[model samples]
Target: MTATLDQPTAVATGVVVRPWRAVLLRVEGQWTWYRRHWTASLLSSGLQPVLFLAAMGIGFGSQVRPGPLTGGMPYLAYVAPTILVSGLITIAVAEAGLPVLSGFKWKQDYWAVASSPVTPGQLFTAELVWITLRLVLGSVLYLVVTTLVGGWTSAGALLVAPIAILTGAACATPVMAFAATTKGDGHAFAAVNRFVVMPMTLFAGTFFPVDRLPVVVRPLAWISPLWHGNELARGVALGGLRLWPAVGHLAVLVGLLVFGLVLGRRCFRRRLVV
Candidate 1:
């Protein structure tokens, strides 16, 4: 008689591990790698936002006077929160794109881990947890710099951290799902940066009001997670956050997050299981 060992048989024999435990183990592995090689991430995710704020908010802002355009605040204060959110979205794109593709295709790390007891859903969850950690750390650093550079207008600006994290996760999860479906040398990721990331950063109310955009193009901003995040962050930071509007913005971000999680899990399962 020949016998085969598998997860189902292991579970029957009382060797089951909890799902969250598996997810945490994967997250720990990611953290271990990141701890050893976090400098590049720090450069893009931490320092880049500060450079953007200095250049756009202080440098060019010096030439422009605040008025209806700035929502009646200093340009630095007006643009700071949105810039933070946009920067996170950019980080999300980078994290969720090539790295995700590499896990499945170039590196085949997902397959190697799948040969263990870890499931695809756990892997997807761990990826999200790691991305969220990056967003949280980046947001904190950006907020600290914003406060130091006189970009913060209210104590409520502190709330931007959560908003930025949500915005990043919303962007990251969907891109992670897309990356799972991609093949080749990750050329699609470049197109994503050019078409999706750049458009969202430039037109999604990051640097200016969406209403300032051409009427035909305004809908693009409305669909952007960055725009929703920007609105929430600016409202709380600069004051004047209306109840219904805040709820609506939260709903949009939450919807995107839920949608991405669903799609990302399905994609991970499809790729890893088969």
Candidate 2:
């Protein structure tokens, strides 16, 4: 007996199959598209970060004397890891916001994919996975540039890649949830970049310590995922991160990621299922 078109091929062969296989297949499709247009993405995720490091961390850092503001280290060493994570967060926000909106609205590809055997939840997971892969590639490239430029202060900086991905996801998943709820020509995405992403990047202790901010504005940095990520990445790179504090920062990032994942999954289901 042969399996019908609707029947599972693995089941016919007396093998069990996992639902996540569909999610992986969807991620593969995303990868195929990314492979073709990766050069465009490389500009933002890779080259842009390198230029920022060279101009801000190296060139400008040379004129500033190391002090309490820089933790007694060269300004470049003090700022490199934070900038790396910030770049990842920027890329993640862009990928998760407008592109997600396009997938549902302009492209309508989500609906077409949902018409198949894949579930809405699987589609969400696939999107998250694809974003993770992109972040990884970008982080690796950024780290290599940092090393060549002598911006990486410690060997432990190698761990920044995974931490950067976590940081990006913490931001990306929430933005994706917002995108799933939007029904417009993506004007809201511009507002998100302006009002949300830009503020977070500027005030999240990426270029300077959050402590330098006015007392009234300090809370904003404390609540920002980029702040936590910057603290962790800088601590690891500079060899100052304590174990308990590291755990606390990791917990916050993980919490945000979980909350966003749940919210995004629900939003995707509501939008795609009906």
Candidate 3:
């Protein structure tokens, strides 16, 4: 007998029995979509860090003298770790915003996923895991470019990958939760970039130290996750981090991740399981 037009052509994998497996399957779906359009993504994602490094760390850095502002290090090396962290934040913002809303409002793949036995929390976890994976891979590439550009100074620079990933995750989770809650068009995403991401990138020590900011507004930088991540990256790469400060920076990232995850799971359920 021939199957009807409504019948699924592929063989069934059956219900995903384990929670971990369900989450992995959802991540696999994300990977499949990425694999198809990876070339276009590479043009933007791959070249961005390289271009940023060349511009800010090389060209602009040449004009900057090594001084107290730069901790006696060349501006290139001084800014590279922070630039790496900032790049991850850029990518995280791009991924966590419109694409997440699209999964719900436009493409509606999320609704299809919701029909499955997978819980909304697992779906949220998979998205976070995928974003983390992107940060991990991007960090490796950015570090390589940093080395090639002479921006790498210490052997400890290798540690910047985890620091950058944590920083990116801290930013991404909350943005994803916000995206899931937004009901309108791309305007909301644009606003996120304009208001949230842009301000943080400019003021969160990506190019210079936050201490340069006026004392009255310095607390704003202190509360920024990017600033904390940048500090950790710069400290490890340049070798000046005190033990207590490192712990404090870590606590902030972990706290943000947990808070975002709680909100994200709730938002996903509200949107998808409706």
Candidate 4:
């Protein structure tokens, strides 16, 4: 017997579940794109962090004494985890930017996928997965440099790369999902950077402690995934974190991702529907 176009749909409704097809599409696209131009990819993800680490950690760290991050830990050690988080932040934010806009407007992949067997939820899943991969890749390079350059003080923090990526995606996915809702022109992401991310990057205990910020603003830092991630990552790097704090940080990351996924799926549905 021959199958018609609706046969796949009928079969799926009856008994079939595929969780990550959209995710595979994203990862596969990254693999293909990177294969064609590996150098630029590395430069953007790897080299960029290395330079930032050199200038920020090593260069400036010399003047500062072993401070709060170390409780005796060097300033460089104190700051490495934040840089690691920064790399992931960059990648996650990028996933929300041009590519998302292109998918909606230029490439119309969001529309194209809808005509296929994919659901908006699946697309959301795929995009989040892809963003996670990109963030992770960027993070690992930064971590390795932290180790090689002595910015990372202990072996424990070696595990922080995956943690950082998860946290970054927790933050970025919802932001991207929000971006997906734009009809045509969207500056929401730029606004996020200028108002949201940039503030988090500076005051969310990345360079200085969140305690240093004003009391009113300090409460807001609690809402930043980067701050939570940076704290966990730096503490782990310094061998300074308790188990409960680590779990708490991870929990926040999970919550953010869930929130983003739910909202992003809704946004995708609204934006793609003609």
Candidate 4 off by > 4 Å = 1-17, 41-43, 68-70
Across 144-188, the per-residue lDDT of candidate 3 in tens digits comes to: 888887898889899988999888888999899998988989687
The worst-scoring run of ten residues by lDDT in candidate 3 lies at: 43-52
Task: Summing lDDT over every window of 10 consecutive residues in candidate 1, give the lowest-scoring window.
Answer: 1-10
What lDDT tens digits, residue by residue, belong to model 2 across residues 199-229? 9888989888888899999998898899899
Using lDDT as the measure, the top candidate is 1
- How far off is residue 101 in model 3, in Å? 0.2
Give all candidates' CA lDDT scores.
Answer: 0.88, 0.87, 0.87, 0.76
TM-score ranking from best candidate downward: 1, 3, 2, 4
Candidate 1 C-alpha lDDT tens digits along 55-156: 999999888888999977889999999898898888887999999999998888999887778888888888999888888888888888888888887799
Indicate the TM-score of model 4.
0.87
lDDT of 3: 0.87
Better of 1 and 4 by lDDT: 1
All candidates' TM-scores? 0.93, 0.91, 0.92, 0.87
Q: How many backbone clashes does candidate 1 have?
A: 0
Which tens-of-lDDT digit does each residue in 1-274 have in candidate 4?
4666546554444432365755576568767877788776676655766787788889988888885544677888788888778767866776677678788888887788775667777777887777776676777777777778877667878777877888778877777777787665766667877887778888788887888788888889888888888888877777758989888888888988888888988888888766
RMSD of each: 3.9, 4.2, 3.2, 4.4
